[model samples]
Target chain A: MAEQVTRKPYVREVPRMLWFLRHPRYMRYMAREFSCLFIGAYTLMLVVGLKRLAEGPDAWAGFLAALGSPGAIVFHLFALAFSAYHSITWFRLTPKAMPVQIGDTFVADRVISGAHYAGWALVSLVVLWLAGAF
Target chain B: MATSNKPIVWGPFAAGGTLTAFLTPVLILLTLLAGLGHAPDLLAYDALRAFAAHGIVKLGLVVVIFLSLWSAAHRLRITCYDLGLRADTLVATLVYAVAIAGTVAAAAYLLRLNPV
Candidate 1:
């Protein structure tokens, strides 16, 4: 049997909470991840709205009235900003996750992300149309 | 070694993230419009109620909410880990539980909404 050897590896302790603060890219990444909080809360608000709608006209009206408050408007403004940031970053990252190949050639990144932008525009138009924005 | 169940959560996170990227900004804008008393006619209370009363629309809305909640929950879980929370299992459980509760609540409400 060979003699047993012991080895110690040097490990640098990173300050977990403040590590991201060391780099601008990390800060941006954290912002992108943080957008989910606003997105999730906005969805929950929609769920609450659905509940109010289920409760009848009076309840639905009350819900809308509540949304008219200055605080709610500010909240929505912030949510929209964060959500738009999330969308931009998400689109930017999509080509890496999904690479399309045809005849031994992969699709260009701009083409892939541009397609997403086009789809986003089309969907927005449809939603606006459905909401009677036309 | 045990097989990781990461994909189960990852699947919804990806799908929901895509959906939100495409649609969430617009949805939030709609609410902002409503708050400003400029809601489109189709989004007005009665019209919205009628729209929700449709079976297909109800199903679609529930799916959207479910995916959105799950995506946010999973991302939040990762964020907590990054922030040094370290208690990943507990964080995962809490966030996923909230997501599930939101989904169930949305479904229940949509099911009860009747067309006038």
Candidate 2:
């Protein structure tokens, strides 16, 4: 029989709500991470719209009309704001995730972030142009 | 197993996160503004449908949707873990399944478009 060793381990039980409030960084991280939920919702909406488009004109038009509702408008507004937060925070984090080296010197974080913004603008313009909305 | 490889999911999650970083805001703004009936001439249903009829455009849409959804799923899985949902494997599986399902549905629909 193996001898039993008795030991008590101390465990910390943290209250899940307001867990980030104790630290500013945790709060920001949580805010940025949670914004993905809004992004996901918007993506799901686009998928539905795409399916409706495939279903032909009436379904597509119905989706458009549904988007005009007060509730949808409100949700969309919130989604837009959250997505902005998500984009900005993610852009800020990109440099840390994938650092760019220019020659022997490391690229500045701001430069990397700036390039991301520039690319974003150019892509947005292209998408707009392709859709003939520009 | 706690030692299970996470990089498989992480790679897509990171890529998806990056993709959404660039595109989500633009999509939301355009969609909501169009929703409010301010859709520009180029964005009218027929025009947008026409745009989707291209193979390259359809492929691009699939890539964007897949990455964004997968990233969101990864985020949700982390959120669940943080919230004390101790069953990491189950939560991860469930969330990832949702992302996969959404991506498959989106791809199927995009493929069904009239590639003009």
Candidate 3:
């Protein structure tokens, strides 16, 4: 009787140098993390506004006056770009954060993101209208 | 375990994302207003003072403060995890703990009847 040998499946070890470059998900995770810097800066601006409000009317006026400056406008634009990126990506992650279900069926991530965009659009419209922008 | 062992990228996206999440819309509105060249009269300080004096603005302020703080804290927790901070669970707990404390402080400040 001849002895039988059992062969195991071959598994190749991935090179460290190629791992991140080869993985799209890791790249996205990185993009997501970097977005926080803008978030922190914008939050500070709001906090400044709040503090001005706490100070008194003249101070609040001064704050708004400062906001109207060209420099402030530029800052606002930069803030807007980062913010928009954050919102879209955050919504993209919504399915993972809060999985939606209806009648024993799971809703798709795209649907969830779309709904969020629609909702935000409606809210923006309403806010603009209330502000007499339209 | 192999899947979990992969190194992740933790960089500008984290900070940018968090900032963008809360400030983007407000920036847009501000930009549109600026573009219109209609620099509205500065918000009356008396109005804010009045609200603070009355308690409504105080409450609103508190809510905004707490919400924004908590959101930032949560994002920071995830950012730390992405940076290869192995004790993610511990960091997350600490982050939430700080957020809760800040939130409670906000609420307490708002609920006080006396105004200075």
Top of the candidates by TM-score: 1
Task: Give the docking tier of candidate 3.
Answer: acceptable
**Whose TM-score is higher: candidate 2's or candidate 3's?**
2
Candidate 2 chain B lDDT trough over 10 residues, lowest sum: B39-48
> Per-candidate interface C-alpha RMSD?
1.0, 1.7, 5.0
Computed on alpha carbons, the lDDT of every model, listed in order, comes to 0.92, 0.84, 0.60
Tens digit of per-residue lDDT, candidate 1, span A11-65: 9989979889888999999999999999999999999999998998899889888
DockQ scores for all predicted structures:
0.79, 0.64, 0.25
- Could you tell me how far off, in angstroms, the CA of residue B80 lies in candidate 3 after the best superposition? 4.0
TM-score of each: 0.93, 0.88, 0.61
Please provide, for model 3 over A37-120, each residue's C-alpha lDDT reduced to its tens digit, 9 standing for 90 to 100: 555555556666666665555776677778778877786777666666678788777678779899999998899888877776
TM-score quality measure for candidate 3? 0.61
TM-score of candidate 1 relative to the true fold = 0.93
- TM-score (C-alpha) between model 2 and the true structure: 0.88
**Which of the predicted structures, 1 or 3, would earn the higher TM-score when compared with the native?**
1
Model 2 steric clash pairs = none
The alpha-carbon lDDT assigned to residue A18 of candidate 3 equals 36
Model 1 CAPRI quality: medium
Model 1 pairs whose backbones collide: none
Model 3, B30-106: lDDT tens per residue? 53474446632223455334445566766665555555555666677777765657688798678667656765655
Candidate 1's error at B24, in angstroms?
Answer: 0.6
